[model samples]
Target: MDFHKLKKELITYSKEIGIDKIGFTTANPFDELKSRLIRQQELGYQSGFEDPDIEKRVTPSLLLEEPHSIISIALAYPSKMNERVESKKGMRRGIFSRASWGLDYHHILRDRLKKLEEFILTRVPDVRLKSMVDTGELSDRAVAERAGIGWSGKNCAIITPEFGSYVYLGEMITSIPLEPDSPIEDQCGSCTKCLEACPTGALVQGGQINAQRCISFLTQTKGLIPDEFREKIGNRVYGCDSCQTACPHNKGKNFHFHGEMEPDPEVAKPLLKPILTLSNREFKNKFGDVSGSWRGKKPIQRNAIIALAHFKDETAVPELIDVLVKEASPVSRGTAAWALGKIGGEPAFAALVKAKVVETDSEVRGEIEKALNYYK
Candidate 1:
């Protein structure tokens, strides 16, 4: 079925469905990715999702029975005014990264791809289609690069000239043999802004990211954040975009993908007080639809406590004292003690001392003692 014409029709249909960019290519073998993941595993970069058989599981070729073509697409979700993104003095900006500012990309991108597939089926009835939105075994950046969508930048993100690194990537794996776009050449010369701007040194040489050290992954990972990395996480209560913010390629960019894709102002640097009081139901109602809510309120609450602690805002003392008094979660108690220690003063000391007496968890007790030491 004329592959070139099919690809063109697919791109046209995809745009109508609201996707910003679309390109077709062969499935990447991800040989380089597998080797890099192995090395990262050795270095303890993937501690949270460290599966011995990760290479076997996440490989692109292993996902589909007889995958012949890949259709990669991009969606732009840019931040609104620059004021929302600007760094504040005592309080950090609470903006979601550019990609996550709207409805979850997984659902949005999948819906668009489904429509594209339906259009293809009308043209070729027997076409077999499979798609993924970051859940694929495929190396998304690799597939994106191979499709001429964008080059993988030093921050380990796809960088398109039009959308910069702010575009979300999704793909379709099909049995049909569509003509493929050639891979784009790397545009990052000697610039190391992304690597240099990484607070925890997660980005090493040659676009490698240490997931264990990545603030974005750590905040979402279902485990106690390692103490060494916690301080470096700073005020990023959710995902981080420090490297992307530092990239010259991402600065002063215009997004023309979807007219409705504006960043939500309420989420852009929200007050520290309200976020601290989110009930589980309320948290779910607000964030459950987004991709960041996969871990539910536990991690986000933990991160909020951490960010408040890192900010050392004395204003949070009253709310923290309330949490210390009534909150039952051991993790909450432990983080509260840590925050108290960071906030350090008469009020925080008194709360820590009171919490220490009633706290049963050994870890929480330990944090309480550490906090009380500041008073001494």
Candidate 2:
């Protein structure tokens, strides 16, 4: 079998199936990435969401027995929405990052991978292959960078010359020894825009991120956000895009090739207040298809409270007071307590004082005390 011919055919088929870009590389262990990850761990920068096993992350053989090559694919997502939702005073809305603008990318990329697998199976009947996306143990960015899909950008994303970093990445390991593509040169030369633009300074330096300080990671946590980051979080209810949006390469790189990749403006920038009252079924019905909803409504709700405070929406005060008095989740109630403090008025101040007396949960009461302290 001519593996080179097969690689070319695979690239063509990938483009036909909405894969914006594809590249191939030898599946040797990611030696350089292993060291960087070790340093990342030692510096306490990991988000605790990734797999803890270092070997499985860097070694392709562990994921796929006798893996000889890796095929990396990228699907570009649109950076700007064609339709805009009003985020003005009376109709404030929370913004999800560009990555979460459309349908969940995991499913989209998985579909493309499954198609690629079937195509390969028909050519080499006994080929061994394993595919993975963002949630997989194997690092998708490392595979993409080595596979020549893009250079690993200073913001810790795969920066394709064609798509910038606004691309969803996935990979497949195979037993076939396909000739590899050359990696693109890093073009971030002396650009400090991303690091300077990070609201929480999550971008520690070029090509390194402290995920603990990242608004994207913090918004996904199912707890009260630290007081310091609350104001900095602004109106982002899902992931943060400060680093990517600030990059000069991404300035004019918006693309909407796939139909499902187009964002529904209403869903992408939903009204902040409606998010607070979404029941599990309602939340699922509304945001269930978006990738950001994987953590469920709790974090989104908590972040919504923070967004309300960021807007100082006095109109949301009545509902926020209800959350403090009647909501079951201590995280939501606690976050609401803090929002009341941030958006202070007679009603908000009174609610915080009343909740301080009756809120039995230690954490919730602590938040209540902190909120009341603002009045002092």
lDDT of each: 0.76, 0.93
Sum up the clashes in candidate 2.
Answer: 0
Residues 1-376 of candidate 1: C-alpha lDDT, one tens digit per residue:
6888877888777777898889888754767777877777788767454445766434556777777888899887664543444445545435345555656778888888888888888998987788887766566677788889999999999999887888888888888888888878899999998998988888877578878788888888765677787778777767888988888998876665564455455564455556768988888787766666777877777777777877777777888888777877777778878888888888888888878888888988987887787766
Model 1 steric clash pairs: 94-269
User: What's the TM-score of every candidate structure?
Assistant: 0.92, 0.99
After aligning candidate 1 to the native by TM-score, how far in Å is the CA of 238 from where it should be?
Answer: 0.8
lDDT of 2 by residue, 1-376 (tens): 8887998899899988888899999999999999999999999999999999999999999999899999999999999999987888867899999999888999999999999999999999999999999999889999999889889888998999999999999999999999999988898999999999999999999999999999999999997888889999999999999999999999999998988889999889999999999999999999999999999999999999999999999999999999999999999999999889989999999999889888899999999988888888
Q: Best-fitting candidate, measured by lDDT?
A: 2
With candidate 1 superimposed using the best TM-score fit, by how many Å does residue 174's alpha carbon deviate from the native?
Answer: 0.5
| Model 1 CA lDDT for position 124 | 84
Candidate 1: where are CA atoms >4 Å away? 47-61, 81-93
